[model samples]
Target: MVEIRTERLLLRPASMDDVPAFHNILSDAAAMQFWSTPPHQDEAETRDWVAAMMAISPGGGEDFVIEQDGRVIGKLGLFQFPEIGFILHRDAWGRGYAREALTPVLDRAFSVHGLACVEADVDPRNAASLRLLHGAGFEETGRASRTWNIGGVWSDSVYLTLRNGQRDVG
Candidate 1:
């Protein structure tokens, strides 16, 4: 099992046990506000999503659950090679958990996986996510208007990239 332990978090592969907590996070309106899809309606939706995630070969595609005090609190992972994404239960936000969870994952991406750079795309209006990425040493690469039609809303995207060893402050 691939697990990365930080001072306050455990980043581990997703499991069937996480579906309920995952569903809770995915279905929370405020938490899903910046996500590509709207809040999931039910557990079945989250179940299928979790099933797919679990099917991926371990460590072949990065998808980790953020656990704190033995409870699933969030997730951070590469959705596609080099493009990272993450989500936390609204209750878990603003406590530096994202940074704590992401820093080591970035290390693994660059050191273990040998990726030269990691990229991210965020809705330009999401100030919190922007700050998190920037605080993690990601530099803005570009921005495009109407780049994503998320939940029927045309959203602009801010692109950022972090080259290996570019910034170590996370």
Candidate 2:
């Protein structure tokens, strides 16, 4: 009923069982510097977060946690609009994990979800995410100002899109 296996990752729907590790990642301020919220401080809250992610129906929004060797190192998936969001633990940086992890995420988004295109919005300052998105075959469309509200303050994000099957920009 769950689990979307990639070449090097074993992605699956987040569950209550993944709370501890999920919290560890969610609570890392440095890792989530540009996130919409501060670090999570409660153990029980992690489940609610996972539950919320699970609540994202494939018909609209969907999500999956990126795992390898039985541990979660990052997260990626579609959230309605065929838009994909990805977050990696800072420690997992510079190792090509993002590229490997995204193969299946993109595969599912386009192949399984039947979407014509997928989008990714990254903080312009987030070079790693930008590089990752580009390597995953996304093209920079433009910049969107005041696109995200992170802890009560509006911030800008770089919008990127990946076309699937058949789509026309014109």
Candidate 3:
């Protein structure tokens, strides 16, 4: 079901229908460079992820499909801790879809949900993600060594957070 709309986008629950478009983003090398696992080449994996989201809302996340011009470019939304996470097709980067997808979600997280704070954890190496989050009002609170598991290996992680009243780090 579609949940919200921006001037040029649609934010909505992802469907099995989105698997192919979603797969394109997932399979892009540049898009998944910093991802814990390699992107999925098959639609089955994408469907499985979508199924999980349908099963239980993705563990405190309100996952949304970021659609533009009737095409799915990526998935974007709020996860647990009210933090924002999004992955856009490499082709769609730099066009402000990230902000289009995140702004309303952040508003809902702070204003509607009354979340105390929201944050994002980025791999230290993901410069694009860092810039995107910071541009969307996230700040790096600190960095932790050996903090997360990705591709079965522990890696250092960056931690960031946001508070109420629309206050943000960047």
How do all models score by TM-score?
0.94, 0.87, 0.87
Q: What digit string (tens of lDDT, one per residue) describes model 2 on residues 35-145?
A: 766667786777788778878865887778878888888788775657787777778778877777677767767777778889887888888888778776788889978
TM-score leaderboard ranking: 1, 2, 3
All models: lDDT? 0.88, 0.77, 0.76
Best by lDDT: 1
lDDT of 3 by residue, 1-170 (tens): 33899889988887788878888888787898777567787878878877765554544667688889898888887744476677999989988788777788887777766788788878999887887777766777999988767557777889977667546522
Model 1, which residues run further than 4 Å from truth?
A: 58-60
| lDDT (Cα) of model 3 | 0.76
User: lDDT tens digits, residues 1-170, model 1?
Assistant: 48888999999988888999999999999998888888999999999988877776645568789999998999998756688999999899999999898888888788888988999999988999999999989999999999878678888899999999797654
User: After superposition on all CA atoms, what RMSD does each candidate show versus the true structure?
Assistant: 1.4, 3.5, 2.5
TM-score of 3: 0.87
